[model samples]
Target: MKSKPVLTILHRLAILAYVVFALFPLFWLLKVSVTPNDLLYSEGVRMWPSRTSFDHYAFVIAHSAFPTFFKNSLIVAGSTAVTVTILASLAGYALSRFNFKAKYWIVALMLITQMFPLVMLVAPIFKMLSPLGLTNSLTGLVIVYTAFNVPFATFLMQSFFDGIPKDLEEAAMIDGATQFVAFRQIILPLTLPGIAATLGFVFTAAWSELLFALMLISGNDSSTFPVGLLTFVSKFSVDFGQMMAAGVLALIPACLFFLLIQRYLVQGLTAGAVKG
Candidate 1:
């Protein structure tokens, strides 16, 4: 059956409406970030304020702890993303290809790790890290983030590996390449999309995590951008301008990281490797 032109136009309109509806808040945030404070309340809910200024941006960068927060968040998130991706790729490939004793149990255990709520583990994790003096440290946060992200990342990577073929590595091995060499050369190249996806996933998770950072790190020095965003709220009122400005700034690194990896994020690196 052929669809009507009017129905297709309506369908496109529906999608466009949903997209704009979902993105409206972000658009508002960007608008308010540049809006002058004097006009914040006086403007009475206008889109694209009549006047805009970079004063809040300047203040957040120069007068606040936003820079430190940005740096700490970057380091923790970048480290966690890289570490988790490395571990995940290796484990995922193993899960996809190897048939060893207890493989089922190992996969089940990793899945089990994903089942529990992270909130439930906070107390025990804090107690464990406290004795080692790691609670207040950025390294501690990275370690925790990596631990949480790895299982999911492993699963993500495993799906990608499963999508790829066994024949490519088998061929490489037949050509005298070791398993590691074959993986590093042939398999890894095919899994670039999975790697980019995992890295972006882990990085964004660690970047915006606030509850754990708030619970673990008490000092201003080690606070991540999410936690620092909270500091903009005083006992009486929130500094909307500065907070919005900081939020906009915090989005930059994630945007940049994705932009850097987007080239390899295209699907189907393994299309021709196997027969249908």
Candidate 2:
């Protein structure tokens, strides 16, 4: 009995340690952004600055094109996540519920797409999109993100659907409901965790995407926050404070996204524990 409390304490301490290790970089970025430029180097690796100010944040918001970049990122990431989730849900349900002749081949082809490095596809994708006027466009970025994310999202949703009992839908069918209706009301509601996880995964992937954004976008008008962070660098020097400030701002949407979906994720996890 005494050892149980000790184990519990050690477990919590381990988790706390991992959390600090993960968050240390972000904490340092926030610290540096608030540190005055004159003291940045002179402070010599201090945990917190002696003097703090919001001048970097002020400059980024008031004088830079960060707001436009933020807007572009929100549009692209949000659009991609929604598109991927909807398509993945339908595809996943099919994979879970149906057994067709081409099912194995379809799964193999999807897996093949994941085996190749994305860098290998950049030139071919760019070549294809350029003629369609998709290069240097937010819509192009969204399309690319959605296509890249869907296969994995489909697999994820399929696993979630597999966890659900087929009898639930079967019972609904016995009650005169079609497969689609049972899936819409019963299976889909039960897969909220999977859907939320897919949304967060796709949203984060689209939001932080740099290679595609850098390759496809040309000007500030279409730039995402990842690409926009480059503006802090110049021939003479890098604006560390402003760059960190922009990074901090970029994290806001991702944080808010998880916050919105966290309830569904928790609910989904606990749903399996209860019995009717």
For each candidate, what TM-score against the reference? Answer: 0.96, 0.96
With candidate 2 superimposed using the best TM-score fit, by how many Å does residue 106's alpha carbon deviate from the native?
A: 0.7
Tens digit per residue, CA lDDT, model 2, 1-276: 366888999999999999999999999999998988998999898999999999999999999999999999999999999999999999999999999999999999999999989999999999999999999999999999998999999999999888888888888899988888898888888899999999999999999999999999999999999999998999999999999999999999999999999988885453553373
Tell how far residue 207 is off in model 2, in angstroms: 0.3
List clashing residue pairs in candidate 2: none
lDDT of 1 by residue, 1-276 (tens): 999999999999999999999998888889989999999999797878899999999999999999999999999999999999999999999999999999999888888999998899999999999999999999999999998898889999999999887888889999999999999999898999999999999999999998899999998999999999999999999999999999999989999999999988987666777786
lDDT of 2 at 252: 96
Clash count for candidate 1 is 0
